[model samples]
Target chain A: MKSARPDSQGHFGPYGGIFVPETLMEPLRELTRVYKVAQKDPAFKKELDYYLREYVGRPSPLWFAQRMTAQLGGPKIYLKREDLNHTGAHKINNVVGQALLARRLGKTRLIAETGAGQHGVATATAAALFGMECTVYMGKVDMERQALNVFRMESLGAKVVAVTAGQQTLKEAINEAMRDWVSNLRNTHYVLGTAFGPHPYPMIVRDFQSVIGKEARKQILKAEGRLPAAVIACVGGGSNAIGIFSAFIKDEGVRLIGVEAGGLGIVPGKHAARFAGGKVGVLQGTKSYVLQDDDGQILLTHSVSAGLDYASVGPEHAMLHDTGRAEYTYIEDADAVAGFDQLAQWEGILPALESSHAIAWVVKNAGQFAKNDIVIINVSGRGDKDVQQIAEWKKGQSTK
Target chain B: MKKTRVDQKFAALKKQGKKGFIAYIGAGDPSLDDTVDIVLRLEEAGVDLVELGLPFSDPLADGRVNQDAAARALEAGATFDGVMNCVAKIRERSQIPLIFYAYLNTLYARGFEKAMNEAAAAGIDGFLILDMPREESGPYRKFISAASLNSIVLITPTTPEERMKQIVKDASGFVYCVSREGVTGVRDSIAEGARGLVGKIKGHTRLPVALGFGIGTPPQAAEAASFADAVVVGSAIVNKFHNNPHTPEGRADAAAFVAEMVKAVKAVNSPL
Candidate 1:
């Protein structure tokens, strides 16, 4: 009867809480209550399932990377192809679930915070499908670096607001989104794109995204006739990693590893390696490990992949890390770029720089596994959104 | 029993047939010395209590004025120790009931038990952490209550009746009744529903309820005091400092602005 979760008050051990303003406490509590009712409603379940299959193109394939296994000379790497999902990232799964709830709540607008724009695109896509107005708050700097995603999000009918606040990154984006939610709580639903934030958000997002792990578990059993030896995914706010890892945490034989962005190195502001540089503190509502300074200001984070650049991980991840249920490690930005190139060359699959973090970990530790052992990597997003940035990065490197 | 400063102030205000008025300002707006100067000036201006806002990088619940003041403080070398040091200076000069108006991350980052002890030792009489809800406030409440510091709770218009009961049950100091359904800012009119919300909270707890968030002008604060036991003026005072340069001149300007607000608050008929 062991359950690793956010408890009744939405705490996962010392992490996770409804740390919000009084204006938001009611909404968070209400959302938590409604989400519980929605879970048991047969009609609600049917509608969610229908949209998951028809609208989002769910049950994304589990592909075996034959060439990658041969090149690495280790365990068979099974790719749980989340990149094949309709919005090109696993972000769509959570967005679709939240959109359904928004519709039920009679919300007319759906708002979100985006970093690399994958979540914005996914949120925008779901908003369009649900015929709800969408606004996305992104850091001004992020909007510039992720211009293509900005365009894609705009094209999908979301109003992309450039936040010119502190640090101008995902952290600021979230702050802006929270401000928006506080002002327009009645008619709006802030579709937080990750498995962070306060109560119900972490729980709701994890439940929606558990499909990845559930699907991969059945698919892996069929492909290898047994559970994989390990499961790996990149951890930002830890949505995708938790999505895949939730299904495997109980399986004692299955090793769960979350790869964090190592950026340049562990020199203070050089990385988003929360496990390496973070201290246990609260930020963005939930109590988790955070990269903060002595003055309690959240420090600027660095990751070549915009999506993986975050100061904190999910509360559940904090709990897991504390209990020794999951091991989190780091992959530097240069190594992730190298992994991106390797995946493209070997498997003809250009991985998103975010997902490439997991791939980098896979290649670095391939020697640790046996030939028959299997390791499944959750390729969280397609690389079309990253190609322009990657090309620009290469140009900058050549000039150097 | 060592009556906490918050309780003593409310009781005295109650006996005097006066409505409470708490003035909020960032601890290091422009510089720490100005902050110490401003709090002392605020006491002279008739502010019953001072809520010294400790700035954080991400102030999610603040409006532009408060946010800008925080930015200025942070830019001017504001740190946790620095703000606390400023509070210690203010304590030496005055005993106006002082509360550290801050976010959960700022306090939690400082460590729960340590924050309570240091806050108390540094002359903070109470706390109104902007983010930590009652459910997550167990450790915070435990530590602060044991140290005999007031742990104020925030209540809003949207709070369900059942949840409000739960929130007030654990509430030690007065409940902060949000005057409007928005972040902290200056508004021409208070929430039209302010009176009813105050009445609802009054039914739940005997602790004095202070309405804040958008109670900007003197008339607005007066209107709010007509119903609630206290009216809070934060952003408007912060706005005075916000619009001016973060200098001694700016601090003087904001202090003058707070004086006007105090005059108006002092004029309010004490319904309590």
Candidate 2:
């Protein structure tokens, strides 16, 4: 079934569209055309599916959180184990698809932006497999926090360029990546890290990443003999959340909940809570719910995890919020820290801080659900890259 | 309704057999007071028109120079009210054509109707939103047309001829022809694509076609002026003010740079 989105001109209701310069318009149109052709070609589909299964290791286990579920004393919690994938994260799922698309487009090089470095590492891994030149743009500050992932990407034959612009974070890294993509459009393909940006990108990323939900739907039905009561995932640019949500969108029995980073608190400038604090505005390429000031200037966001430290979520998330099809909420840093610690102790699974935000929501709200109800949280990545930051955060908390 | 200064200036330039020069600078860079001084200096340097860039947080269409200029302006507390006030102050001194060059988001954030009334009151003659595609300019064009303000649309080298015909139909003051495919910046030579684009737009519209983006040096300006009705210089003048932004020296550098461009543009034996 065709998804209802991004009409002909690439607008998710009123949120998504091509707002880039004339330099990028033709390239975007070309990309859109290429993606459309690829969608209809079975050879393209067979290749993408083969990579998902053989290379990235598809259909990641839907492990029942037996200990955590019993301890919670209410709903049965199933963790969608995207952490078990190659590169220890679900990020490889989308990258593999985009890399194949890039190869078909005859692009010789790949460029991407990273905040937590999962996407960069994933893109670097795909580039190596495809024998394509790779460049990753990372914020200077993020490189300090995610140094290990930076090293990992470089070791995988990708040149990591440090961006020193505005706050030196995800948004700035994307700005630099965009500048590079515009300057080098002839031979380079920008492997956008998430389900954001302009037309075809958000739609394409969502389609590629939807493998998670398709597998989860089948796994849950076989294990529990029913659909999950609610499906929850952490939303930065909402790639993982939208990936899982799209497969279950038509199933009215399933509820989709997107958890944003609440950061420190719900104060004026402290949180990355877009629905609560943001307004509709244009940035980068797509127009979505953005955390901006009265004069349409973007505001900086705070989060414990670099991956979730963004000013806006995906346009589909905005559409979902507007349509009331999905519930958007936030879990603060302290709660996420507790979930990060408890999941390690209870399930022996060290979840990335980005994924821990989803765990935090389930941890806090599990008691409210019925005993017969089942919930699945997308554990998007393993916390291996976050070990140093987690240790530092623990030290900071103890010192206080 | 009063005749727009852009129209008046273009008519006079046609009679004198000279092309026009539109100078651009980010408002409130260093300070709003300095912006006023820069505009006055640019006018004094014989620039035919001016593009007052309202600072936006994420100007995706801009290159490094304008981006830094906006960051400086935003850092120094440049606001919508502040830009309008600067335009009002410039209006008090001269009747030079002024266009509000901004991103669509900044324009929408101020409430379209309210912003138009405020801009009209502040002596803004027109608008050019960098990120607004031709498809999304419907409501904005309506608002602009209602206010009798010119809504300048850009025609790029990549634009199809049929689309260019439709796009230029909404253009009131003039058609802005981007000299290159990339974002705004200073370049060594003009894009070979620009000359053909200017000629194409001319075949579609009776309105004056002003070419801009990368016309930095005098020779480039003169070269652009030869085929185009007017030449618009942004990053080159902005780079000068951005280098010194503090004293009379920065404004002096900007004025000097614009004076050379103006002279080069005037030297063109305008076929129009």
Best by DockQ: 1
Give me the runs in candidate 2 sitting further than 4 Å from their true place: A1-3, B1-3
lDDT of 2 by residue, A1-400 (tens): 2355678778888788887765677778888889999999999999998998898888899999988998888599999999999998888999998998899889989999999999999999999999999999999999999999999999999999998778888998998888888778879999998999988889999999999999999999999899999999999999999999998999877889999999998775688889988999888888899999998888988898999999988899999899888999999998998999889988999999999999999999997689879999999999989989988988999999
Off by over 4 Å in 1: B245-250
TM-score of 2: 0.97
Q: How high a TM-score does candidate 1 get?
A: 0.97
What would the per-residue lDDT of candidate 1 be over residues A1-400, giving only the tens digit for each residue?
A: 1485678778888788878887898788778888998999999889989988997788989999999999989799999899999989999999998999988888999999999899999999998987999999999988988899999999988999999888789988998899999999989999998889999899999999999999999998888799999999999999999999999988988999999999999978889999899998888888899998875788889999999888998999988888888999999988999999999999999889999999999999998899989999999998888888888888888999
Alpha-carbon RMSD of each model: 1.8, 1.8
**C-alpha DockQ of every model:** 0.74, 0.55
- Model 2, global lDDT: 0.89
